[model samples]
Target: MHDIMFHKKIKKTLSTIEEVLNNNNKNIDFDYLLLDNMLEITFSNNKKIILTSQIFLKQLWIATSNQGYHLLYKKRTWICIRSKKTIKKILKKEFFIQTNYLFKLNLLNNI
Candidate 1:
């Protein structure tokens, strides 16, 4: 996809995530910052999750405490190239591990 299209997609996805988190802030306390094409989520425990879009690669990259995942748009979903897992699934799992709370994200509506 073109740079503009990729940026738009990333912006929409980040906005959706922010909305969801804001609506559920009582249950999950966190702060988020959107800088350029990146979203940085900081949990109450000081754990951080970063989501960044690579325009040239046309991929979304997610970084957590222990590892980083590069997700490519494929089959109507963003999936990890090595694990073949969806970004939403990975995020849910990672968030739960980091916060001991389930991360419920409805990516279908945004994507």
Candidate 2:
């Protein structure tokens, strides 16, 4: 994808995540910040997850306390290059592991 298109997709994805979190603020115990091309999420336990857009590579990168995932936009979905897992699936698993909270995030459906 072109840089512009990649950026637009990233922005939309981040905004959708932010909207979901905002709407569930009362039910969830976490805080988030969407700055520039990064989304930073901090759970109540102080564990953080950072999602960044790599414009040069046209990929989305996710960082948690233990690991980092390089995700490529493939077949209309963002998938981890190493694990072959969709971003949503990774988040669902990681969030539960990190925060002990099950976050049923379906970014693709929202998009």
Candidate 3:
């Protein structure tokens, strides 16, 4: 289990990241955090959901087999790709984009 202080830090960092994403002017619905080398995110698709990944997260300088990052921002879906090779593969393949954000207020909304 994680301590309250640690969780608080993650929450704060997520807020900052949210501002950064929202500034992008896309319609996004998610919050994100960096835990060690992994990123834990809360997002919504047809509905709300949560997800976790340990790779391909550039915001925290972590990369795995994946190469692109997707998010909902400014009411639009946007993708940030790290490498062109990975981007090409992801674009060529038919894959479901699974990503979102979970903010402090989002918790309340879920409740």
On a 0 to 100 scale, what is the lDDT of residue 57 in model 2?
88
Please, what is the TM-score per model?
0.89, 0.90, 0.27
Q: Taking the tens digit of each residue's C-alpha lDDT, what string does model 1 give over 1-111?
A: 778877777788777777767766777778899888889999889999999998889999999998999988776668898889887788888888877887667753427
- RMSD in Å for all candidates: 1.6, 1.6, 12.4
lDDT ranking, high to low: 2, 1, 3
Q: Write the per-residue lDDT of candidate 3 for residues 1-111, one digit (tens) a residue.
A: 135533443344344444444553255555655554244444454322222222323221222234434421111112233342222233223122443322222221111
Local distance difference test values of all predictions, in order: 0.82, 0.84, 0.34
lDDT of 3 at 8: 45
After superposing candidate 1 on the true structure, give the runs of residues whose Cα lies further than 4 Å from its correct spot: 108-110
Alpha-carbon error at 39 in model 1, in Å? 0.4
Better of 2 and 3 by TM-score: 2
- Global local distance difference test of model 3: 0.34
Evaluated with TM-score, which candidate comes out highest?
2
